[model samples]
Target: MKTEKGFSIADLKMNNRLVLAPMAAISDLPFRLLCRKQGASLCYTEMINAEAVARNNKSAFRLAESHPDDQPLGLQLFGARVESMEAAAKKLAGTEKFDFFDLNMGCPDGRVLRQGAGAALLRRETRACELVKAIKEAGKPVTVKVRLNPNVLNSIRVCKALEKAGVDCITVHGRTVKQKYSGPVDFVSIKRITKAVSIPVIANGNIRSRKDVKITLEKTGAAAVMIGRGAIGNPGIFADLQGHLAIKPINAMFNYLKLFEEFGMDKFGRKKTQVIRFLTKVKKQQVIELVQKAGTEEELEQALAELK
Candidate 1:
């Protein structure tokens, strides 16, 4: 199928304009692969802590891991210090298969904010621009994810600064750091950023359906839409965005479980719990209970088969 106009960052070209947001814990390899299969043009690894990567932390490195099938993936790094961010990016550039790197200035979690790493950068414009410059110097196609600042005008300032720092693209989540995930998304702010920046701008927030995707792209004139919570248990939303029917939850869950095992994720129990919760939103509670009770993957598969 033909895709939206080509989205390129330097020499890298994506198959489509739809991108999967770099969600913490939720955007793991299994979930990314599933989104890719369902039509996500590009996927991002969960936010990686640069300090942990600089320290050679195994867990942090694992978060950035990808397989051959997960091509065109972006590794998002979060850190307040330029040296650590540069060190981590340079090291991963040599060893990782991601096509690009994204600087995380949009995350609003209290932990990230406390470290002055994520949305806190909104207030420290100089430091944020410096970090973008350092990462760009690390020799990779780079992007910055940012949020609308309280002043709104400040968001445009940051986008321009990032572009001047030579970032290839920018993602603008339509809410401020204080709003976090609640309240209405400021699409007008997103539109303003897209108008002010020369590079591609990806619009994120409250994008739950195909109609929402269409409205966002049309209204904001963004290059693409980034799906977060909306894609959790329903990767089929990507297919639906392309005009196909949604994939059955049961079948999608089966595929996710298969990929989960294939990837050999260590936290199967935790992931399984998450899967059950997402499924419960769409599937019967009794069916979810049965799946949860099934201890082994084999048992889980059988239970899913029964649902079919």
Candidate 2:
């Protein structure tokens, strides 16, 4: 078997190129660190609202927290306005230690889109170009995550604009706002975008297993792959993609559970059960089903009882 090498967002060679996508509510410090430990070449902070960061919101502070160990971490922010987005980028560049900054143009949530943030910016190509230019001015390797265009012509146009704006790379989530997360990712469209741009393109959307990683790389010709929902609770996928299976699924489960109990509960001030439920939502059933089956509801209750 051939081994796959990794690269940081700076193009620094790494152990693997698998990136953990920034997921809202799930990609906390603990989760991202776990993925790093499990061999992810890169990881990102959860998508933060740029408005919140620009306003100096304390909640935004939590979004950028990281341990010394979590190096090569990317901080992703979402917004539309040039000044607010630029201010947020400046804030991150000022004090927050991060490997890079990512603009979230791919988020399709109605709330975000309606506000002219996230995927809404993709529709406004001129503004998206300017936003990328602002981040580039911040002296960081700027990456942009964009949704696939409802019209392919727009996809190519956005790619051209981002490249011209000097983004280091563009992560194309191969689904449009209208498509949501419905069908299979449109790798063909991603390929077209990749071909249209000079900068690196990281293909994201529905990348689940090791095989899928290789196929996505081949099909889309992206410089790398970013795993999102598929990576939740399955940190070992990072190692698995690299031809190293030193970490087991059970170990990953326990590690994720402990992390959830620690940072998750403390940060949210929620009961352990509530935290456990939220973590489980991102976790696959196969990993948690065994634990759930071994313990009765009461026994499971006892497991989390120690948490609070």
Candidate 3:
């Protein structure tokens, strides 16, 4: 299904090249719906711990919750154990909700690294491949997201191995583990990977606007672009990138609040954090302070209305 507007990975098809990265404590069901409502073609759940999911952790399962409208969703899994990864994939697949599984081989979080997962897996390509193979046994299209290797361009070999191991797609973040989220993205390395791989290569890192997406796609020749921190405050970035009208962050936040209630998500902590992200761009510091101190959603909503 290669076309001007869409592409296919195995049986899953995406109508556009915009995807929301699986962010910790961020990419929830409501967040996915808002992004998709605007224009994101594919969305992933917040990174779920494979070991936690395998152990049937209620909190981990809650993070993977989705609605019928949240179509073409990918449940992101991160951990080092092949047995745990397999069990987690099987457990989620039995629910018949997720469209695919995204293996998190790119996370630079020290906590994950300490557990022998994330970018650390890049150092263990054999184990990463083994984890992918075990996840594949659960019978779903699997994708791996990774950073540029410690040696940079060496990431090509990692993607190549994952591809040979039957991964449906690979996403290259274009930054080494050492750089984390601070340095410039290596588009040259991403471009080289696109040239080296036969499957779709998604270019990620520092893409925040439509212009940024265009430049990344042109420079890397990637099939799509994944937005990470950029989409946190503005889910409308997807619509803007897709040639639609630019959506105001405040407006999108209101929509998020609506969805928040519609979906019955009661976690005030998650709600407050999302509100703060959506309004972080607002120049009024007092408003953010008020938002932070607001004891209830109503108080927060009233405070946000002041921005309008």
Counting clashing residue pairs in each candidate, in order, gives: 0, 2, 0
Question: Against the true structure, whose lDDT is highest?
Answer: 3
TM-score, prediction 2: 0.85
Candidate 3 lDDT, 1-308, residue by residue in tens: 12137767888889988889999878998889989888889899989999999999988888888988998888899999999999999999997498889999988888999999998999999999999999999999899999998674568888888999999888899899889898899999999889988999888999887678878988999998899998997888888777788678888888888888897888998888888888785555788789899998789878878666
Candidate 1's C-alpha runs over 4 A off are 1-3, 287-308
lDDT of all the models against the reference? 0.85, 0.76, 0.87
Off by over 4 Å in 3: 1-4, 297-302, 305-308
Give the lDDT of residue 132 in candidate 1.
Answer: 83
Model 2 C-alpha lDDT versus the unseen true structure: 0.76
- Tens-digit lDDT string for candidate 1 (113-232): 999999999888889888887787768889989999988788898889889988889998998878889899888889999999899998899988777887888888888889998888
> Can you write out model 2's per-residue Cα lDDT over 1-308, one digit (the tens) per residue?
12255444556454566788988876877777778887777788989888898999988977887778887888998888899888888987898888788899988888998989898888898998898888777788888898888788889998898888878788899998888887889999999998998877889888777788878988998878889877765676777767676465446545665765666435432223333544474554443444354334455545544334
Query: Residue 175 of model 1: what lDDT?
Result: 89
Q: Is candidate 1 or candidate 3 better by TM-score?
A: 3
